[model samples]
Target: MNQQNVRNFSIIAHIDHGKSTLADKLILKTGALEQRVFKDQYLDNMDLERERGITIKAQTVRLPYRSQKGDAYTFNMIDTPGHVDFSYEVSRSLAACEGVLLLIDASQGIQAQTIANVNLAMAGNLTIIPVINKVDLPSADPDMVREQLEDILQIDSTEAILASAKQGIGVEEIMEAIVERIPPPEGDPDQPLKALLFDAWYDLYKGVMILVRVVDGHLKEGMTIQMMATGHTFEVEELGAFTPVPKRIDRLSAGEVGFVIAGIKKLDETKIGDTVTEFKNNCDKPLPGYKDVKPMVFSGLYPIDGDQYENLRDALKKLRLNDASFTYEPETSAALGFGFRCGFLGLLHMEIVRERLEREYNVDLLTTAPTVVFHLKPEHGDMVVIDNPSNLKKQDRTDTILEPYLRGTIIVPDEYVGVVMNLARDRRGIQLKMEYLTPKTVMLQYALPFSEIVFDFFDHLKSSTKGYASFDYEFLDFRASDLVKLDILFNGETVDALSMIVHRDKAYYRGRELVKKLKEQIPRQMFEVAIQASIGGKVIARESVKALRKNVLAKCYGGDITRKRKLLEKQKAGKKRMKQIGKVEIPQEAFLAVLRTDVK
Candidate 1:
């Protein structure tokens, strides 16, 4: 393919912004996928993606189009996920494209990820073409959304493309915009090959397949290539682009996006953001903006059965092939036995990992409450990393505990501003800025601790705003806070899995509610089970599960008062002895049920 004829761009939008429908229309117009095999959500190959109607992984396809002006162009359209949890995916996708179609829903107007991704695309030097999608809906106000685009992104309303992607409206105009507005790739194919490994996934039969963008040179089969980051080398076994699915091609030249099979045996060999180049002809400098993904939330994943621990480990290895954002290590808890301490980008990322494990791998798992990384400095020693909250018990009171904070943004309707402000205040959010984009829409910015919103922030935000709010956030820094470890005790034994790091002011209230919830979950036993919330061996709150009792005097109903008293005394004495030896059998359900104990 001619380099001048190739146009590299990606579609960026918020979740449920009609991106998949738009892609289907363009692909149909360009004949990328055949009509017989075409189904809804064509690019969303995974079952979860199709079920959720969202794109989780980034996808690319090559389309051949002949414009009305009699010019043929090979358009490389990269599709990216629209969720904030996958914002990093958007950044990586932007790095591979020369331009982006910033799609906005004509009814929803500007959202959090819309602003975030626009800034990211601009930072990556990608051209932005504002697109107003879903214009055919009765509630779609194209003029209002166009004004939002202008007010927030400074986009010219006159240049905005209005179309309904579902009904194949303005597809020709979109194609024309690509040919006229977007720039072609610029590089020398004759030079040494340098490709960006934007994504990679393991194949059961073919080994690890890497998705790459040919930045400088050509990639062909049988070529020996080296990974710039890990210094691993292997010969290319297969090479091709997703002609929607993998179609074996002879070569992928400069500016083309495709996959390279280099006989990689393990998923770890191919790192996302690593540069792939020829072994003999190497590039001078590695690409800029190459950084490892930092997981913002941490949790524990233990199998329901002990034997499935190995299976859990293997499943994670397979899942991590494409998802380098999640990291895990072997960890053990006294209450849950053996498990892995896993790190994730956020709660949604963690939830998806758990769901995929149960559904795809058919392995049941026990997950702990999600937590963020904490920095604890002892009074006499160096700083310690606390990924799980259970480790906080060892810290001294004189030590400094620094908690992670984030710069958060929320865009919602003006009517819900008061509710949102109150929610933020309760979560320790400090208002940074508030602006009115339109008469009905308002945007709020706040600085909040990671621990505050990592669990239920999105859920509450949706409820308060009546599903009209969009939120996005990034790490700011770590600061010292008045934090303490709140421990949950069952039968006088501390359960490490249920321990939490809480602020001192809210400690007593949270402790009370937690113990009450635990009391409701634990089953009644022969011996009374006492559940307590404690700090440094001091009990702050307590709840009790009453023991099951049987009447010991029923057989002596006709006996005298002395006989009845003797029976009662003997039964009481036997109960005391049983309490010393009887053990409480806690089912796996009790541990998992604690997460659902929402006090409010």
Candidate 2:
């Protein structure tokens, strides 16, 4: 195929705004799949994505189309995830495309993530084609959505196409616009081979399957390619494109998207944003790789069965090949034994990873409470980065604590602005800006601590706004604050996995609430178990789980007073001895008690 006839683009939108659906319609319109074999969310092949109704990974497909003008063209489309946690995936996909179809829901209008993705596409200098989706809905307001495109997005409303992806409407117009508006890739096919590695995954039989967008020259099956970042070379075993399904091709020319199997066993060798070039005739410089993504939330992932530690490690390695954003390191906890301290983009990202590990790898995992990174400046030494609360030292040695903050954006209905503001204020947020996108919709910006956003913030925002609010955020600089490590103790022993860093003022209140929650979760044992929330050496709150009574007195219904007294004394002595050595079994729910409490 001619490079001039190839159009590389992606579909970007807010969650559930019809990105996958639109991709399906385009693929179907091109006769890429038979009607009987076609399915919804055709590009979302992962079971986790299909079950959750969200696209976690970006998927690519090549479409063969003949325009009404009788010219044949090839459409390479990448469908990207919309959730803020998966924004990195969107950025990677955008890097491989020449344009993006910015899909907006007609009924919902603009959202926080929609703006975030638009900024990403703009940053990449890609052509943006505004498409008003779900126009056929009963409550859809395409006219209002068009006004939003003009006012909020600063895009020409007249050029915006209104269509319903679910009903297969305006598929032809979208295809035509993609061809006419998006410029063809400019690359010399005669030049040396140079391609950008956007994504890669581990394969059982084929080893590492890398997805690349050719920028300069051609890549063939027998060519030897080098990863400029790793300086490793390998002979390409296979070259192909996914026309909804994998199709073998003799050569992938410049300005094309395809996969390459090079018998590379380790995924680390094929970096996400590295440059792939010919070994003997490589380009002068490598393409600038993607910025490293820092994880926001950290938690401990321990196998329920301790022997599966190796299995868990293997599972995490394989998962990392698919998701380059999350990170993990070997860690040990006194209560949970050996585990990996995992970092994720957000809570949802953490949940998805845990689920994939459990379902796909058949490993039962015990996940601890999520926490954000904090910078602690010791009075005697240098600043230390702390991800786990258990790492915090005594307050006397710490001069100051700095916590990460976020520049958060929330879009909601005008009527819910007051409630949303109250929610932010409760989370110690400082208002940055607020404006009306229209007479009915409002956009709010705030500077919030990353710790507050990690737990229940989204849940609270949705509940307070009646599920009308859409929120997104980016990391800002860390700021000094009055923070302390709140620890949970069972039977007078501290549980490392249950500790967390919190603001000093709220520590006492949260301590009381946490102890109460843990009391409910900790079952009664043979000996009375004491649950305490403490700071340093001082206990702020405490609760007791009463020991299970055996009723020695019940067996002495007709006994004398002396006999009853002797029996009671024996029971007390036995309980005292048992409390000295008996261990209190803390359930998994007890470790999650921190999340159930009102930390604010």
Candidate 3:
């Protein structure tokens, strides 16, 4: 295969903007899969992705196409996730491509993620082919979308291809645009082997399989390759590209995208952004790797049964091999026992990881409420980064606390701008800027605390705007805040898993709501169970679960009033003694009470 004939590109778009559908149509048009075997979202192989109707992991495929001029070409397409949570995936995918198909929803036009992804593509200096997708929809206005592409994104909308990915419209034009507009990957095949390891996953039979985009020279079986980052060497046993499925190939040349099986057992050795080169004749310097992804949301993942702790640990380790953005460290809680303090890009990322651990790894996990990283500076100590609220138990030790903030970009209809502003303000967001993208669409910028958006902020935004708003954000900076740790005590003992850091002004209300929710979830015990929410040593709210009444008084119903009084007193004493020694078992629901966003 000639390097000049190979075109490496990726499809990037906002959520529900037809990226996967476009990829499917392209694959089908290329005859990569037979009609009988083809499926919707063919690239999204995971059940979770199919169920959620969103792409989680970026998928790569090789399409063999012939241009109108009758020249055979190999198109390497990486389909990327559109959700803000999976933007890291998009970035890595972009690194593997020389160009990108920037798909914009025809009806929705330019969105927050559209702008974010366009910025990313521009940063990488990749050739972006503007694609107006879903043009066949009843509400679609391709002319309006074209204006948006030109006005907002500064892209030449005259060349923008209007297509319906679902209906297989304009598939040929998209393919032709790839060949005409997107440049062929530039690499020297004669040079020593140098490739970028963009992704990898663990296989039960073949060990770790890595996806790479060759930059210089060729990679083949029996070649000894060393990872530039880890300095680990392995002998490549097999190499192939996915024609929607793994098909073994003799070798991978420069300007190509494919997977390599190197008989590597451990995944950590194959870093996502590491450069791969020949061990004996390696390149002098590694390729510029990807930036390290920092997690936005943190939570505790504990096993339902304590004995499954090791299994959970093993699952996380294996899962991390596939998802490099997800991070975890050993942690323990007084109430939840041994667990891992896990970090995720967002709430959805956390949810997907939890679901994968349970469904794929068969580990039943109990996840704590999500929280963002906080910076705490104590009066007599250096600055510390705290993810768990229980670490803030010594409130007096901290002189000041700083919370992570985000520069949020939200695009909504003009009619919903007021409601969106109110929602942002309610979340402690400070308005940064507001502009009208068009007469009907409004774009808003705000600086919001990361902690404020981790839970139900997206849900609220969608509901408030009637699902008309699209949002994307990036970390701004940490700012000093009046934050306090809200602790929940069950039977007078603080439950570390239920503790959270919140704004001091809302602590009383949140505490009150938390205890009330807990009161409803906590079952009545033999002794009166006290559920209290407190800050430091001061209890702010309390709820009591009454002790289950016994038949001691029922048995003495016919007795004299004095005798009945004596029995009641004795029962009361017994109840007091039980309350002193009895342990209140907080149910799973009680532990999840902190996740209820409507506590107010």
Cα lDDT tens digits for candidate 3, 313-370: 8889889989999899999887878999999999899999999999999998888888
Q: Rate the local accuracy (lDDT) of all candidates.
A: 0.87, 0.92, 0.91
For model 3, how many clashes? 0
Query: Model 3 — TM-score against the truth?
Result: 0.97
Give me the candidate number with maximum lDDT. Answer: 2
Worst ten in a row by lDDT for model 1 = 591-600
Better of 1 and 3 by TM-score: 3
Q: Give the TM-score of candidate 1.
A: 0.94
lDDT of 1 by residue, 270-337 (tens): 77888899999998887773577889999899998999999999899888877878899999999889
- What TM-score would each prediction reach against the true structure? 0.94, 0.97, 0.97
Which ten residues in a row are the worst by lDDT in model 2?
391-400
Quality of model 3 by C-alpha lDDT: 0.91
